[model samples]
Each structure stands twice: as structure tokens, then as C-alpha cells.
Target: MRLMDSSEAITIKDVRSARRRLEGSARVTPLLEDPHLNAIAGRRVLVKAECLQRTGAFKFRGAWSALTALGEGARERGVITYSSGNHAQGIAHAAEELGIPATIVMPDDAPALKLANTRGYGAEVVLYDRAGGQSREEIGNRLAEARGLTPVLPYDEPLVIAGQGTAGLEIAGQARAMGVTKAEVLVCCGGGGLSAGMAVALAAEAPGLRVRTVEPAGFDDTARSLAAGERLGNEPGASSICDAILTPMPGELTFPILSRLAGPGLAVTDDEVLRTMGLAFQRLKLVTEPGGAVALAAALFHGAELADGPVVALISGGNVDTAMFRRALDMLDAAEPGAA
Candidate 1:
């Protein structure tokens, strides 16, 4: 149980105390915007959505900020992790609304509607064998040490990266109430917990907002471990229909907070994440899930590696199924014949 150790010092006051313990238990989700994705990313894109959060994704604000910041005798001695489905239904619906007792460890090629909605939020899933290498974090730390439990680390801990940086503090106050002083956000990452917890809450509340991280192409190991500054790995059988951001590396505490607050990491292309999950269900109806449309497929096909302001992105999950949302509306009606 002595797990946390990547220097443990998450800041932005632990994402504003996990957004004041997720005010009324998380769900500030929407940010949307769409002028046909801002005229196809010529700028101003937005999106945040978080797959309409709540158990749909954004890993339930770091699984309810790591199980209500534990320690009521470690939430009654029950918890455990490892996921391949929106943090296993955000730690099985925040350990069944705090009654605790979870135990995910999924990935038998997950996404059977996220293993039946993580067993309909009752937890106790345990599948393993992700393409046979087999380790859902060593079978969720050997069944959380044979059931003593308490682990909730779906992304290098620190209260689950300050509960995924409270959705980057609600996307920096909804992109500064949409006046958006400056932008680039884009997240859909994997083991680098919500893009290193939204680049440590947009480097402390939108320092002209940055955070990047999308991924998919051969599980772009956090976009080549943020272009080889160190941590790298994903190639041993490398596969991806965007299986929830695929993770083969990038987490020893989310790579030094995504190499000191991210940017320069993007990869997309499971056919551009099924055409950005068919352009987020034909223009903002939203329902993404090829690993949440790889940050809106890098805000609609990597606009020349971005950098002129206004982007956002972050659709991070929607659970998807039904023949993969009918192959993402048949690849957005073969790339927009009548636009799906």
C-alpha cells in the first residue's frame, strides 16, 4: 500500500483542492463551441465536453479525486485500479458513490461497452491479457494485495493527478468565459493522466493556456514521450483502435508533470480517430470514443501543429459501442458525402 512516489508534489494547490472536492461531486462538463468546428480548425475550436463527463469520462475527475481523498480507514479498506475503459467507469462510479469497494483491472480488449459499464458500476471486473502481455498493473497490484485494497491509481496517483486537475479547473473557467485570452488545450492522452492533469491546471489557471497530449497512432506513447526527453516505450505489439489511449509508458507520476507542463505532443489517426468519431457525431451532437476522438483528432487534423490561439479539444470519453457507434457513422459517411 505504500504506493505514491514520483516525488509527490502536485500543485495548483492540488488542483484547487480537487476543485473543492468536486463541488457537488463533479459534472461541470460542457464547453462545446462549433461553427462546424470553427470552420474546420482555422482557429477557435473549443469542445471540452469530457464526453459529457460524469461516468462517461474525464475519468470522473480523477475518479472522484482518488476516492474522496481516502482515509476513513482508507475508505473502508476497498479500492484498486487499472483500466482500459474510462478509468474503468471512473473507478466504478466513484466506488459506487463512496460506499467504496471497487476493483476494476480491465482490458481483455476492453470496450464491451466498457466491460458492461464496469459491471454496471458495481465494480469487481478483473479481465487482463491486453494482447497477452498481461499486466493490468500486475493484475491490479495482485488483487490489491489480496483484498486489503485501497489503490485508485488510474493515472499516477497524487490524488489521481489532482483528480485530473479538476478538468483543468473546468478548462480554466470555461476558457475564461469564452473570451479565451489564448489557447491550445487539446487533451485525450493516456497514462500521462489527463495531459499531466491539464498541464498542472493550465500552468496555474490559464497562463495563456497550453497543455496538448493527444495520442493514438501505434499508441503514440505520450507522443513519443514528449519527443524523447526521456520516458518512452510502446512498440511491443503496439495496437490501437484508440483503446483508451493505449498506454505502454508515460506515468512515473505523469512524466515529470508532462515534462514540466506540456505542449508538443499529438498523434492521432486510427483513421484520424474514426474521423474524430465522425466529427463528434456529425457536428457537436457529440458521443466520441475512439479514445475520445484523440483530442478531436488533434483539433481536426493537426492544424500544422498548432500555435496561433484558440483550440481546446478534450472530448476524453463517451463509452461507445454498438459496433463502434456503427464504425463511427461509417467513417462519417465515407468522409462526408452528406456528412453522415
Candidate 2:
């Protein structure tokens, strides 16, 4: 699983191939702009609304890419993976659509909506205790071995990275259509799958658009690893409301791609994430989970750290529970002094 260099890893060619596979499956979500968001950032702000993606997240592209890439024999044999929420639902829905048996290992603390949706998509769900030192990888691996399930790793797999890159292809074309030639593309990074994939795509399709990884404050492993010029893991037991992007470290394959093509990473606080989530619904009428809002949070609050140009922020997912959405909406007053 070693990607020693960028050349050996996923490339633009791989991303293009993935786009072909995803032609009728994955949605090319919208690239949106609002004057209110621009006024808040004091610059042009474009939002890649991946929350509108199927299963309420962009993970579907990767799920379809990985599952379909497997031979028919393997697909009939079933597949397994681990995720907090978004990836779980994505894999589940894609599996259901393809009529493949799928199993997902999710933390017990995952959002209620995500857990329900994953199961509703007809996959068997296994719950693990994330805060109690239980390893989802170990659980998934054991289950996979016992059930003869082919493993579809959430981010580390090359096919998954390539599939996520299709979004980058769309972003390049959409931004260009909007007359944005150069800008920073902010991505909410968990294990660097989406950001790395997008970097690969943008490097070839839109060289002027650069990617910047965004993470919740305490879980900013990707940002720290980029700064250190090597892989770095988050502190043990570090926690945040942004559960979707909380990974122990970056993926082995994705880090090299990110290090090569991505700009410096960024981190945002849970408060900022909540505010962004609130503002997204209020202004753009888009529901965003905390983890999914980190990129948008950086776009609005960390503008000083961004390059001088239009900012493209990816709202990575939107599978939030009612209570969490209410909590985010409650923060609207603090997010803007006079907003209702």
C-alpha cells in the first residue's frame, strides 16, 4: 500500500477513467455563489455543494468507483468498509443499487441520520466504540476475513481517490464557466481522499486552481502533516464535533499526491464550523454537517490565510440529524451580529 511517489499513485488519467465509470451514477453537484457569503469573506466565494450529492455526501463517487472496479466475481462476493457516517451511507447506497451485499462498520456515536440512512440503504451495520479504544479497521478486517468480503478502504484505496477526483473535474469546468481562472479550492479532509483526488484532477484540468485541505481544529492531522513535510498522526483521543473528517492520519496513497499538488492546509474551530453550517442553511439553503462545513468555515473566517482570489469551498456532506441542525442554527446570532 506504499505510494512512494506521485507518478506511481493516482494521476489525472486515473481520475478521467473514474469519471467515465461514474458517468450516469455520480451527480455533478453545483458550484454556487452568494453575495452574502462574498461579503462575509470580503472576496468572491464559490461553494461546491457536494452536500447535495447522493446519500447526502460526495463519498458516493468513490464508493461506486471502487465497487464497480472490482470484477463481477468479487462484487457478488460482497464488500466491507469502515466509516463514521458519510462513507457508510455512500457504500451502502451504491451497494444496494448494484445489488451487491455490503457491510459497514460505524462508530456507535455516529449521527442518528447517518446511521439510519446507512441501514436504510440495505447494508448490514456493525457498531464499534470509537471513544473506548476500539479500532474500526480491526473490526472491519475481522468481519471481512470471516465473511469473505472484499475490503473497500474508505480513503486509502486508489480507486476511491480517483473517483473523488471527478468532483475536481467538474469544479474546474464550473469555475471556468463562471469566469474564475485562479483560486484556492478548500476541501474538508478526513484522510485526504477528496482533496488529493481533486488536486490530481485540477493539476491537469485547471492548473490555476489549487487545493487546500481544511479540518476541524483538534483533528487537523492533514494540515500538520503538510506543515511537517511528512506524515503525522493526530493526538490520541482528540475529539471534535466534526466527526466526518476526523482521521488518525492521512492515507498512505493520498499524502504523496497532496504533498505534491495541494497548497498549505487549513484548520477551523468547531464554533466556526457550526457558524458556517448555520450560514449555509440561512444563506444558501443548504444543510451542512459540522465535518462537512470545515472548508466553508475556512472560506469565511480564515480568509486571511487564503490566497488572494476567488475561494472555492467544498461543503462535503449534509447528513446531519435534526438536533445537530438545530444546534447549528442556534449559533446563527453569534455567527453574525444582526442575522435573524
Candidate 3:
């Protein structure tokens, strides 16, 4: 079995098709003013709540759009995928909705809550060693071929990127209606799906706005790759508290468009993300996972240029554990917002 590459690229046509395919399925998460955090940044910040999306994350939009885009014959054959967490649950839930069987390969140390949720959606789970997790593409392709299942990639497909782009589309629409004209939209990065997608949609819809992507500092292969103007991988591996953003590099399907739309990339520390997550919970009364808090963290601490105007922050997910959330809050409470 051969591991396939992503679709050629992201385009307006693909985004439109994805929007049509996922119309009734994916939730249109809100983009609203977060006055409390706005005052902190001294900038008008509005958060796009992908955290409230179905499956508690934005992955569902991409998965559902991709799955629904499949031909009738392909849907009948079922689907296979590999994911550490969010994408696993997303593919599982999307597969269930489409009446397609799903087989998800997950790392053994993958969060139990996510693993259980994936299983609950009727996906067959195969746990591999976390330290030695092999090429997910190779594994997924093998299983897909063996069982005549369709391989649904998490971030490397045109349909997936287009679907994820809808988050940006919504942000643009809502932001404009709210009287926001010059926004700098920031989105968290993983394999570049959400950031890439949002960048495309934002470029198309909010042409004047700048779209920046934020990633976990050490695990920011996408940023490095974008900076070097080449496809680079996190050769050694990714180690970060924001587990979901630990992807190695940018997706083949998303690169061209991201390079076109996403002006540049930025990175933040795990501590910064955790601190932002605590701030989000306390100030917005929203539960945000570390992976989702990167955008907010960047704007709060590093967005000095846009620190005066309307800034749209995409809160990508909210799947943190209770204990972790409490601990992050405690630690953030202990930290000085400014200290020597």
C-alpha cells in the first residue's frame, strides 16, 4: 500500500465546495468580543470559538467535509486514519455520521479521554508505541488497503483544508458585522491545516487583514519550514505540552496557499500557552486546551504592533483535562503578569 500525498492545493473552489458539503453538519462556532482579554491586550480582541465546535474542536469541519466529499463507492468502503488525539475523535465522529466504519491508529500514550471518545464513536482503535510511533501515513495506508478502506488524511487534503477554512470565513463575516475593519487574525498551528485554511479564507474574504500563525516554540517545524522557504520536518521529533501542535511539518496540499496567504509564523512557549489557557478560563469563562491557547498567547504577549486595534484570535480547541486546567490556573495565578 502506498501512502498518498495531500491534494494539489487549497483554492476558492475547494473552500466553496467544502462549505456546501458541511453545511448541515459542522457547527458555526461564534466570533465574539472578549472584552476582558481585550482590555489586557489593550487591543480589541475577538475570539472565534472553535472550542465549542462539535467534538469540542475544529477538526470536525475538515473531517466531515472531507468524508462527505467522498464518492458513494468510497463511503461504502469505510475509512482509515491515524491521529494522536483531536483528529482521531473527529474522523471517528464524522465517519459515524456518514455511516462509514472507521479504524484509527493512535499512540499508546494518546490522551485517554480522546481515545475513549474515538472508540465510543465506534472506531476500531489500534494503539502503537508512543516513543516509537511509526509513520502514521504508512500504517493508515496499509490498514486502508488491507480492509479496502478509504484513507482520510487529517490535514493534507484539499477538502479538509477547505472545510477548515470555513472557520476563517465565519470570522471574516462576523468580524465585519461587528465593525472590525483592520484585524490581524491569529490561529494555532499543527501540520498547518487550520492556519493554512484560515489564511486562504481570510486572504480571500478579508484581503486587507494579516493572518499570522502561532505554534508551540520547540515544536514549531511549520514556522521553521516557512522561514527557510522549504519543506522541513521535525527530524528528531516533537516534545511539547501542547500535544496537538506537535506535528512534524506542513502539509503538501496546504503549503502553496499558506505561503501565499499566511504572512509569517510565530512561536510561543508551553508555559505561555498554559498561562493563556488559564487566562481564557478565568476571564472568558471558557475552557481552552493548551493547543488552542497559542493564538491568544501570541496576541497578549507578542502582538505589540497590533496591540491597538481589532485583533481576531482563533481559539482552536477546548479539550483539556480537569486536573490540568486547575493546575494551569493555579500556576498562572502564581505568575506575575510583569516581573523582573
Model 2: number of backbone collisions: 0
Q: Is candidate 1 or candidate 3 better by TM-score?
A: 3
Best by lDDT: 2
TM-score computed on alpha carbons, candidate 1 = 0.37
Clashes of each: 0, 0, 0
* Best first by lDDT, ranked: 2, 1, 3
- Per-candidate Cα lDDT values, in order, are 0.81, 0.90, 0.80
Instruction: Name the best candidate (by TM-score).
Output: 2
Rate residue 196 of model 3 by lDDT.
80
Candidate 3 pairs with clashing backbones: none
Clashing pairs in 1: none
Off by over 4 Å in 3: 1-7, 235-238, 305-308, 336-340
Over 304-340, each residue of candidate 1 has an lDDT whose tens digit, in order, gives: 9888867888886787887988987887777645433
**Residue 92 error for model 3, in Å?**
0.8
Candidate 2 — worst ten consecutive residues by lDDT sum? 1-10
Q: Estimate TM-scores for all models.
A: 0.37, 0.96, 0.93
Greater-TM-score candidate between 2 and 3 = 2
Reference-based lDDT, residue 304, model 2: 91
- Model 2, span 1-340: residue lDDT tens: 1112334668789899999999998998999999999998999999999999998899999999988887788788899999999999999999999999999999999888889999999999999998888999999889888988888888888888899999999999999999998999999999999999999999999999999999988888899999999999999766798888889999988999899999899999988888899899999999989999999999999989998989999997888888888888888865446653
1-340: candidate 3 lDDT, tens digit per residue: 2123453656767777788888888888888676667777778888888889998889999899888877788888788888888888899999998898889988887777788889999999988886775677777777887889877777877677788988888888898899886778888888878888888887888886678878888877777777888878876754787877788788776666677777678888888888888888777778888888899888887766343577888886676777778878887779876420
Name the regions of candidate 1 deviating beyond 4 angstroms. 1-11, 16-39, 43-57, 77-88, 93-100, 103-112, 115-117, 120-162, 166-181, 184-200, 203-205, 210-275, 279-310, 322-324, 327-333, 336-340
